[model samples]
Target: MDQNKPFVTEFLETYKRHPALWNAKSNVSKNKHLRNLGIEDLLKVCQEKFKDANTAFVKRKINNLRTVFRRELNKVLKSKTTGSSVNEIYIPTLWYYDLLSFTTEDESGRVGISSLDDDTELQFT
Candidate 1:
């Protein structure tokens, strides 16, 4: 065991569960590909690996770790794609950016979908 680990120990423990390995090869096969390896599902799998040894606090801890990576990745992606700003743009509702799914959705109950109109498009929650 290395001391002063880069990640919190709980996550390391979570990572250790079930030989938690993935690679591009796993996706090349004629199967579900990485759907089972979705990030949130991976997080849940991490939770399950720890069993009751870890709690929701650990879940938050791990999510925070993920959030940091999401932020940095978003920056790189945004820089590559470029963005536009108008004096004013109408959103018409509260919106959330789901980094995991790359989807955006309205918090308020709404039935319509929207577009970014930007060259780079990401899926929204």
Candidate 2:
């Protein structure tokens, strides 16, 4: 853990090293028992380094991270269809944008992505 990095950045960096935390299409990521173990493993690291994290906090942070990443990805993906010029296209400015790219894959084997519209509800397992 680097002392100078922000907690979110460190969290994302640590999370990137664990595919079960982000790669939904993976078998390991799909198993509830394995996913909980992976989350617990991440919580341990956060507790050791940040000292203020708990299971609830870790879970919330993970959800928030994924939510934002999905939103940004959706923006970028949607921008391509709007026929915007290169300069007018939505470019993700989120620092963790690229780091969370693993989640951009369409795990359901669909050729197209449904929008993450404001009216749509996201179900977290």
Candidate 3:
């Protein structure tokens, strides 16, 4: 087991719990008051692990991780369109892929179904 695995896992779990971090189209993510909570979450984790952690350092780290995740996810999604079969689709090799898969959920595409009304009609026997 890699020594850094635990650290990465911890941060990923933290990111998952904070919807403002990954669910870009979510109301919480878009809200000015809540959007930055992801950064705050990471800052807390970093400060606890490394006493010297600062906002700039944590922000940069989070951005880099997000960039990597986006790139990797794009590759996988692209493969689905280009590949002719399941065997040809790209499989993520990064250990963090599983942890980051939650980001693939498209929150923006979700829609609510409204109830429809039906007019009653009289029938003759």
Best-fitting candidate, scored by lDDT? 3
Q: Provide TM-scores for the models.
A: 0.31, 0.69, 0.74
lDDT of 2 by residue, 7-119 (tens): 66767777776677677677778778877777787798789766888888888988988898889878987998899889888989887788777666636365766678879
Error of 3 at 116 (Å): 20
lDDT of 1 by residue, 6-27 (tens): 2344444443331222222332
Lowest summed lDDT across 10 adjacent residues in model 1 is found at: 99-108
Clashes of each: 6, 0, 0
lDDT of 2 at 7: 66
lDDT of 3 by residue, 43-102 (tens): 788877788988798778767777898788888889998855898888888889889878
Residue pairs in collision within model 3: none
lDDT of 1 at 117: 59
Better of 1 and 3 by lDDT: 3
**Native-referenced Cα lDDT, model 3:** 0.78
Candidate 2: C-alpha lDDT:
0.77
Better of 1 and 2 by lDDT: 2
